[model samples]
Target: MKIRISKATIVDERHPDNGKKRDILIENGKITKIAASIKTEVDKVIESEGLCVSIGWMDMRANFRDPGDEQKEDLESGLKAAANGGFTAVALMPSTNPPIDNKGAVEYLLNRAKSGKVQVVPIGTISKKRAGESLAEMYDMYRAGAKAFSDDKESISESGLLHRALLYTKNFDATVIHFPYDATLIPNGQINEGVQSTLLGLKGIPAIAEEMMVARDLTLLEYTNGRLHLGPVSSAMSIKRIASAKKDGLRITCETTAAHIAYSENELENFDTNFKVLPPLRSEQNRKELIKLLKSGKIDVISSDHSPEDEEHKKLEFDYANFGMASIESFFPVLYTAVGSSMDLAKLVATFSINPRRILDLEIPEIKEGVRANLTLFSISEKTVFEKMNLKTKGYNVAEIGKELNGKVLAIFS
Candidate 1:
């Protein structure tokens, strides 16, 4: 029997189903029927009140600690969490234990993440072992199925090394990602450098650290004429910088996380480590500006930056705690609630769906008959509270623990 979904509103602007409510019958993982009514018995039925469906969503930045650090998350559990969060595809970060650097590592990840309802795209390291030294075999990893390359959480400090990586990857049209962090400037930085850090008496990472690195990369992109994606940016100034760079005709793109868009430095007043992320959360003004920037399309995609840190690293004292938030499971609801009214619902949803795949140069799903059953059943008006029972990630970040969310993801069919 086929899976039948009746009266589910379609929201993908790319297809004829953009604003239609129809009965969709899926058989053998393909949509066989789409009409106002269908008289057919099916093995599975997904017809709920006010439900909406769109192309399967994607998260371009997420980590599944396989090959090592499985305690944080393995491939299967990570996919379960992603499916629960409405993502049908995710780009796995190369920051794992052995690290995804060479062609072998990329093959291993692709094999390990073979199935389970989500496509796992690996991001190869810019340097071998992510040591910021000699460049890794970019062409080899690309041949092994890496869509992009990055050093993840560590910026390439040496201009010569970064310059070489950018100039080299341009040969095959591969995109290079950079995390903007100046190690010397913010040596002991713990949180965003502002009134909150001063009042809390904790170390701070100034916005300039992020801006400076972003500026450097933009300059290099102008020089090398390379394709670059600056990610997890959290400052207002950096957004403006990238927008200006884009206007200047440099091949550049950027992304910001849902956590940075939802929470500001105020959340760190309690010294909660879950709020501690690299390119640390900034002031309220920056948060508001981030939403506005996202609405204006300055930020190309909204990623979960779904970094998962285990209890041993997260449950430590404020100063001793590791930096991260296990956030893929909370990306949709948390993001919808924070900017549901501010940003266009269709555009915001696209940020998590088509935009990510487009940036990675992958095929985007369309919600029409005769297509594969790649979709996320969701609702924007539904209210949700993420409690212990609902938190699917191995690590829980406090920002979304008790927050009231404005969206609900029913299921994903692929």
Candidate 2:
């Protein structure tokens, strides 16, 4: 899909080499030339207005229930949701019914995702069956195109087992995406452990559960010297520990979800299960610190963490409900609300697009001349009311369900 983007602000977050605001000519999927008003023959020309064009966005964590759990979400529908959410690449987590523990399942999902327009990289399970007992077939799964290893929604605790998995993934020179939570402390917890939980009479997931586990993982990472991506670090204490680890020169990076930045556990006061999530939301101070880390480059990436659950799972009582949210549709909009007004566009693009692609060691083409038009076009000022009609995921659970937000994903080019 060759096209000439005229009068477009080329925001290649990866390449500070290419100065911003230039007309680009994309020919045969490679950036051909980047210049001011290039006179080139092309099939089509795009008149971009009020648009920030950048290299494709990448979501480091997203759960698309394909293969055995298609009733919740299939590969095709998940890819559509991703595309509409302005993502060109998504890392699929291994939390399916059968779990992506073996090479065959890894191959199946890799092939299935390749059939879609977006690049869907499946993450292999860190533990066999995600039971936290034994390690999965990491070598075979890596051979089958699994980019990283994780247990999806939770940490593979059992210290001995996680230590072995980390060392094994180190053998493949692949990063481990640890979910950073101690399941023992969070048994039956419905929301963040705080005053709100006491008022609502709901079980609480203590923030220390996340911080303690993260602290342990960082120590192991220091000893192992392997790439580690601490995914969805939800607490301020965890953030401080990770920041300190990075300063001490650990080969580690971390990310937080879009919802983590926009909302806190206070939303759970109404006993709304939709606001419930694993490693549940913390205090406003925690949210502010997360934003600070993202802006300061301490936190490496931002993802949708788009875990989807059906109506049967979400509409139940808070304790009976599942821990997940459908953020594939709300990711970009929620981000705009967090820092769009204060931070510059380049930093935002770096968090959403450049950092994640770099973390996966994927090839990132600059938004320059003669490149294939793999890009995301969005307006940070466009406002839209989020509802069922606006959501593409089968799951409608979100903290900002009816809240007004200031951004919209116009299109995704792959």
Candidate 3:
């Protein structure tokens, strides 16, 4: 597909074209020209004054209910949503009916995703069947192209199981991702435990539930000396602990979602089910502290924890609704506006592009000559509204509907 993008500002901090507005010519899936005022004809021309280009974005965590629950989302639709969000790659959580706990499942995901523009990297579950019991075949899945191992949304309560899994992955340097939360602490939790929950009269999920789990995981990391990834550390206290752990040189890294940084518990005041998420949104101070962690480089990546729940499951009573928010396509725009007051464009691009691939140990692409075109064409000034009609996912659990924001995904070259 030959394409020419004229007057697109390059926002990638890794290359020399950081802030330059120049014409880029791509042919046969490779960048052919990136010089000033290039006279060329191509199959397509994407010219806009607000145009911006950067290294392709990647999301480290997203749940697509394929293979078992195709009514919610399949690989094809999920990847389409990902591409619409400007992500060239997305790491899928192993939360399917028959969870990806073996080599066959990993190979299945890779093969099934070959038709999509977005690359799907399956994250094998930490325990067999994601039961939080016996360890799964980590080495087997790793050899089968599993990028990371995680029991998505399931905390490993067994200290010995977590310890053993961590140590086992050391042989291949595979990361064991733990969703930090002590299930025992928030048994009947529905909303974040705070003033907002008090007014809404909903069961509260305490922040300490996540805090204690993070503390426990850090201790296990020290004891086993294993590669551990503490995903989506949401609270101020949790960030403090992770910062301290990093200072202690523990083999640990952490990230937070775009939603966490933007919205908070107050979003649930209307009893909107779409805003209901695990490790539910925290206080205003906590959200600011999360953004501060990004500014200080304590947080590693900013991902869209895009979990799509069907309308039937989402449009129920607050207590009975499934936990999720549909925001893959509107992710960049929503995030760009939400954090524009504080975050610079360069830093945001780095967090979205450069840091994620580093955390997953994947190849990072540079927007330069001689490299294949793995890029996201975007506009930071374009206005966007994330309504039901614009949603690309099969599900309809949109939390930010009617959200007016900046930054739109013009196109993606994968």
Candidate 4:
């Protein structure tokens, strides 16, 4: 398979051709040559104005709902959505019906995703069956190819359990990913706690719910000297805490979602179920703070948090609806539309391509000759519409439909 990418500006900072427009040639899945111009015959040629190339993007957190709730999203559909979203790899959350807490489950996901262009890295459960009562087989699952350990969207309320898990994973140099929220504080809450919830007569989830857990986790990480990744964080205070922890030299990393940075609680004014998400969209002030911190590199990665729910679970009253959005296909477009003008292209590429892989201890691909062609091609000037037809996931819960976004993913090579 031969392909030529003409007049594309390289966005990888590690490459000498960074920010320079050049022709790239790939033969048999490896980069063969790069020059100012190449007049060569190939199986396909890709050329476009404002075309940009980077190391393949990776999503650190996402829910595919495979092996149990395939009706919502299967491995094939999820990988297709990831490829369309400019991600060559995604970390699957262990939140399925039969949770991925064992060696067999981790092996199953790896085997199923082996033939796909988009890689699937399974995240094993932190607790047995995601029950939060006992620790899962961390070492065994890690040996079976699980990249990290997490109980997705399920907060660990017991301090002793989290402490034990952190200490246990340290022996193998594994990272423990935790969603920062205290469920007990907002068991019935529907949206961010503020004027919107008051005006709509719905229960509200206060920012303290997230901040308190983040503080607890940071303390645990500091005491145990273990690597910890916290994310899909929404509160401004939580970000301040994580930033301070980093200054104190704790082994901590965090992430925020595209939806969190792009939309606020204002989207819930109309009772749209698609706008309902966990760590619900915060106030406009918090959204701006998130963007500022992300630009300053306080945040390490940006994930889609692509949770897919079937219509039966989504098309209900706001109070009863599920908390998620099928957002993988719209990930890069939403971020590009919301923050492209104010962000540096190289820094944005690092968040998606370099930082996430480093956090997970995975191999980071380079955009140089003699390397395998794991890359994403995109155009910042191209405009795309987010509509139902563009979605590849089985769930149709995206809230950005009908809006025009600034970027388009041209193709993926893996």
Candidate 5:
């Protein structure tokens, strides 16, 4: 098959044509030519006003409840949602029924994802069955193509366990991803601990829960000299600490979700269950701080945190609802709308594509001649509403429904 992307601004900083409007031609999935004009015959033409093309975007974190919970989301449906969201690759969180803690489970996801357009990089659990009592076979899972190790939403509460995991993975230069939260500090917590929670009478999760754990993880990373990735960080204090650690030259990286950037604890005022999330959205002040830090390059990635739940689990009372929303299908549009003007286009491309690949030790694709085309095409000028009609995932727990977003994904070639 042949495809032509006409007059789109190339957003890859590694390429010579960076920021230049050019026509890109692809034949048999390889980039054949790129120039000022290409009027040759093609099977398809992709063009739009204010169009931007970059090496395929990647989400560093997402949950596709496959293997045991296909009722919520299987590999096939999850990859379709990822492709629609303008991501050619996504790192799968190991938060399934059994959890991906062994080589067999890792291989299962890889083999299943082989048939899809969006590539899946499986993350194995840091503990056996995500129990946090003992370590899983990290070396064996890594050998089976598990790019990283994490307990995914289940924070490694035991200091000794997390320390050992970090130390063990360093032998192969592997990254240990952790969700920073001290579970003990936020028992029965429902939302951010603030005025919103007080008015709604929901038990609030204090910011110290996240801040304390981030401090502990940074300390462990420094002691063990192992690479670490802290994600879905929500508090301003955590950001301050992480920035200090970065300046001290620790082998650390971090991420925040698009939902955290776009919404805050105020969204929970109406008792909407969809706004419920782990590291539950903090104050409006923290939200603004997250956006500011992202523009300054303090945050390394922006993931969807695309957890999916069936209606039975999501359509419950606020306190009973699961802590997630189906977000992979609307990831790009929501993020673009949130920070498109304040951030440089090149910086946006880096966060979604280049940085995540580097952190996970994956191959970073480029927009050059003779290279295979792994690309995402989008338009900042296009308007889109992320309602059920456009949702590709089986999970229907999205909060952005009926909201007009600023950007739209045009196509993905992978």
Candidate 6:
């Protein structure tokens, strides 16, 4: 159905100054006209008063476990969750059982996502099968529509191997997302390494485990003159490292998960498996530093990280429980709750909408005339509760579950 949105506040995010109330026209899946007081003739019209119109949100890192573990989470369910979150594009991580290492898997994901409303960009695996030993067929996968390459679940800390992958991806002018973690430094660590771990009687994942790899990765990136992306970087020190690297003009970008920004090791006192995650949550001080860094333009993007685990895996003891949360549905409201009023609506849209597209080198869809009708409508004043059972994904392990949240995604068009 063709529709026109009138009297809506527009916030493009990429350009904060352009945010103001305006009338927008949409027809045949493309934005036809946008002005302050445009006369629109359409079969349907939406009088968006308090709601804000902006470019569609993009989740730079999402693990939709299809083509292998659909029961955990599939492409269809993931897209539904994304649409519900006001996202129009998602970068699918390659952490499936076989991993997205070859051309066949890339094509399958592209075709599958083509049938959906949201755009899905396949992320190829940097290491074959995510083994961290041999490099995957980067050239072949890139040709098959892989926007970027990453080993989502684990990090390739091996210096020599990572160097090879970086140089290999350079041929295609694509970025290789690195999961920064030093295996030896972080052995069997459950939560963040701190007083919380000691009081809770749990193994600790040291901050150095993440910071060390990030230091090395930045150095290698400089030497190879290749693009490097730090995915879901959790540690405070890691953010500092990335900031320093960027200051030096290193071609590096970083993203932090919503969990990392909202909660901290303090959430682990209840022994909640949903609080556990890769590069586990850090102290409150670390959480504040991350938020500050995001405001300072150090962190380039924010993501869902969206790892899905079965009940058997998350319902067990804290140590044996899986480390992740299903965050797609709760991503926006939770983040808004965390950074409400501190950053204006324009900056908020920038983090979720335009920044992600820039990081992945995607063409940012504009709110002007003649662009695709790709947009998200939302109201920052609204609030809702996070009910796990009501979520679309099979994975119900989320720290924000059952919590009341602000900012609701009203609709998404793509």
Candidate 2 vs candidate 4: the lDDT winner is 4
TM-score, candidate 3, is 0.97
- Residue 276: error of model 1 in Å? 1.0
The TM-score values for the models, in the order shown, are 0.97, 0.94, 0.97, 0.98, 0.98, 0.96
The lDDT per prediction is 0.88, 0.80, 0.86, 0.91, 0.91, 0.84
| Model 1's TM-score against the true structure | 0.97
RMSD of each: 1.4, 2.0, 1.3, 1.0, 0.9, 1.7
Tens-place lDDT digits, model 6, residues 1-414: 568787778886554436687777888888887777877568887764367788888999888888788888888888888888788999999988778999999999898789788999899998899998999998999989888889886788679999998898888789989888887886788888898999999989888888888889998999998989897899878888888988899889898998889989998888888888887899999999988888777878888888888787789988899888988888988888898879767776787788877877889888767888888887777786877666787775766776898887788889
Per residue, candidate 3 scores C-alpha lDDT tens digits across 290-339 of 88778888888788888898889999999999888776887898788778
Clashing pairs in 3: none
Q: What is the model-wide C-alpha lDDT for candidate 5?
A: 0.91
Per-residue lDDT over 1-414 for candidate 4, one digit per residue giving the tens place of the 0 to 100 score: 889999999998888889999999999999999999988899989998789999999999999998899999999999999998999999999999799999999999999999999999999999998989999999999999998999999888999989999999999999999998898987888999998999999999999999999999998899999999999799878888999998999989899899998999999899998999998999999999989998898888989999998999999988999999999889888888889979888888798889989999999999889989999999998988987886788886977789898899989999
Per-residue lDDT of candidate 5, residues 28-87 (tens digit)? 999999999999999999989999999999999999999788999988889999998999
- Model 6 earns a TM-score of 0.96
* Candidate 2: segments with Cα more than 4 A from true spot: 16-19, 27-30, 38-49, 398-401
Model 1, position 328: C-alpha lDDT score: 90
Q: Between candidates 3 and 4, which one is better according to lDDT?
A: 4
lDDT of 2: 0.80
Regions of candidate 1 where Cα sits further than 4 Å from its true position = 396-398
Clashing pairs in 5: none
Q: What's the CA RMSD of model 5 in angstroms?
A: 0.9
User: Stretches of candidate 3 above 4 Å error?
Assistant: none
Q: In model 6, where do residues sit more than 4 Å from their true spots?
A: 15-17, 38-49
